[model samples]
Target: MNSELEALNSLIMTEADGLLYEKGLIRKLEKYGDVFISGSYFLQLMTWRDLDIYLASDKMNEETFFELGKEVSLCIKPAKMNYRNEFIGHTEHLPKGYYWGCYADFNTNAWKVDVWAISSKEFEQKQQEIEKLKFQINVVQRMAILKLKNSVYNHPLYRKKFFSVDIYNAVIEDNVNSEEKFKYWLQIKRGLSLN
Candidate 1:
């Protein structure tokens, strides 16, 4: 287990010399079966040109979306010790886990032998978090529905999957003051629903 953990730490972390991972973290993983990984969506959202660029990009096809999703899930799953998200359980490419990566871009690595006697406990907790995110996704999904219901932009049909706030912002930028552009967005950060 220690060697596997050591191997994983080597594989995922950046090539920067020195211990990318803390010794204490590995010790905890040996007992906890869970270690958070940073450099997550929040970091990307804050630093990247746009929060939803990858999700909003029109260049990708259905296949690419699934692939990216799979890569992301695999990157995060081991840290959370959620093997279900490793393309092992369902055989479908959906994220069943969320592991908070580190804040620095040190490119810290993971240990393949990351074993915790209580893997099941960690997995259940991670699964609950993923479920919460799914619920949030369903709620925001209404924004896409509104775009279609009101015919707010080109390809109202295509916008069905573009549920991110960044995408809404992009559309608003493209069609300045279209009839469907609700004025309330200016006042509220999250904005309000139109009647």
Candidate 2:
């Protein structure tokens, strides 16, 4: 088996404090760093040897660190600014990326008040939705939207690292048009909200 899968299997069998992070999990987290980081500003961890040399750390496992070459280091928050959303030599920024967003507050005055992260793709899709609302005709109200630019988004199917029931309801009851209640934030910003 691949090293990542083997590590996960071992974790499952050994009653380790954490589960192993797979490549798919890595991809998904990188895809949605904004959502995950917002929930885990301090979730990153590393290991040290008896000589105090820094060994590999599990970004996903809050507890232990697998040594280098044993398993891939768990990318704690893949989409963090320092990694993908980073600057090149302190000058140009990486191309603008998106994070997953949900309606935290429906009012423009409170639009940016709520804080969170989202995947870059979901971030763009939500952008399209808000841009849709920005040009809408009367009868539909556009609430001020705050973009979640860094973490992995979660509800149920999402890794569920940053699940928020309240955000789920806001997206469903607001202006979004998505049939799936899972994409709650997108629905609100899109003006297709069920509410």
The candidate that wins on lDDT is 1
TM-score of 2: 0.19
Q: Local error of candidate 2 at 75, Å?
A: 28
lDDT (tens digit, per residue) of candidate 2 on 34-124: 3222211111111100000111112322122112112222322222121221122232311232112211212111111111232345455
Please state the error at residue 77 of candidate 1 in Å: 28
lDDT of 1 by residue, 1-195 (tens): 334433433433323122223423333333223333222122111111111111212233335434443443343343332222232344342332322222222234332221112134544554455445434433234344234323433433322433334334533343322334433442243343433
TM-score for all models, in order of appearance: 0.19, 0.19
Q: lDDT per model, in order?
A: 0.32, 0.26
Candidate 2: Cα lDDT at 57: 17
lDDT, candidate 1, equals: 0.32
CA RMSD per model (angstroms): 18.3, 18.7
Q: Mark the 10 consecutive residues where model 2 has the least summed lDDT.
A: 44-53
